[model samples]
Target: MTAFQPDLSSALAGSACLGAWAHDPASDRIALSPVLARLLAVPAEAATGTSLTLALAAVEAEDAVRVAGVLRAAGEDGRPFEAEFRTRPGPDGARWLRLMGRCGRDPATGAVTTQGLAFDLTEGRRPVGSDAQQAQRQVNRLADHAAAMKGLVAGLRNPPLARLVDEVAVEVGHELARHLRGGGRQVH
Candidate 1:
C-alpha cells in the first residue's frame, strides 16, 4: 500500500473526493459515490454506472490518458490495484481533491470489486497566485518532470537515459535540500 500521507484521514471523513467502483460484469453496475456525482459531470443522484465513462470525458485532456491507463491496470491478472490522480474540477462549485483507490475481487461472485478513499484538499488557506500557490505549482511541475524521466528510464534501457535520470535525481535532491533549509515543502 502507498503511504497514506497526512491528509488522508480528513479527506475520507469530508467526502471532498470521489470513489472506487466494483465492476459487476454480470449486473452491469458500478459501485461508487454520490458526491462524485458532479465529478462524473452529472447530477448527484445519478448512479455510478456511467461515472467512469463520464469522468474520462470530463478530465483535462492531458490527464485523461493517465486515468485511462490506471483504469486499464485494474483488472490485470486479478491482482489488487490502486491509482492516484488529480483533476481540475469544472465550473461547478467542486473543490480540488486527490483520489486514492483500491480494487479487488467481489466476495460472492468473485468478480472485480473497487473500494476507494476520496481525499478532499480544501483546507489550505494559501492565496491563489500567492507565494504558496507558485511554490505548489513548482512542486507539481517538478513532480511531473520526475515522473516523465522515470518513465523514460524504464523504457530506454540505455546509459544515456540513466544519466538523464541521475541528473534529475541530483536536481531533485538539491531542490529538496534547499526546501528543508528554508522550511518549505521540497520543490514547492
Candidate 2:
C-alpha cells in the first residue's frame, strides 16, 4: 500500500468526508480508502487484505447484529441496501454512519461487489433516533391521559360535588402532563 490519498477522485465527488471500497467481485478482495478505514477505525494497511466479514466483526455487537440481515441479502441475492448504524470510533466517543449502496455485478468480472459511501454523522443523527423515542413516549402518555380522563368523567357524574371537583382536578393534571409530553400542544 503506497502513500496514496485513497484515489477517490471520481467516486467521492460532492461527498462529505467519506470512504469508498471497490472490490474484485470474484475474489471478494476489497480496495478501501482511508476515509472509510478511519470511519471503521481499521488500519489502512490491514484493511486492504481483510475480508468484509472480518471487518464487520469489529463493529459493535449490537449494530453488527442489526446489519447482518442486510449483509446476507446483499451477498446471496445482490440485493440493494441502505442502513444507518452506530459504531464506537475508539476511546474518544461514538459516531453514527449512514451507508447507502448495493451489491451488483462488477463491470470487470460480472461478479457482485458491495460498494457504497460511508460518512460519519457526529451531530446529524442524534435528533432522528431521539425524535422517534420521544414520539413513542408521547403516544404512551396520551394513552394514559385518555384512561385517566375516562375515570374522571365517570367520577364527576356520580353526585358528590366534593368528589367531582377532586376528580376534575386529577383529570386536568393528567391532561397537562400529556400536553407537555406532546410538545406542549394544547389539546382540547
TM-score of each: 0.61, 0.54
Off by over 4 Å in 1: 1-11, 14-20, 23-29, 77-89, 93-96, 122-159, 182-188
Q: Write the per-residue lDDT of candidate 1 for residues 44-144, one digit (tens) a residue.
A: 55555654555556556666677555555654544444444445567754345555555577689777755455554554423568674566556656766
- The lDDT of model 2 is 0.62
Q: Where does model 2 exceed 4 Å of error?
A: 1-17, 22-30, 89-92, 126-182, 186-188
Candidate achieving the largest lDDT: 2
User: Which lDDT value does model 1 have at 23?
Assistant: 47
- Residue-by-residue lDDT tens digits, candidate 2, 114-153: 7776766665434445664656555555566566556656
- 101: Cα error in model 1, Å: 2.5
- Which candidate has the top score in TM-score? 1
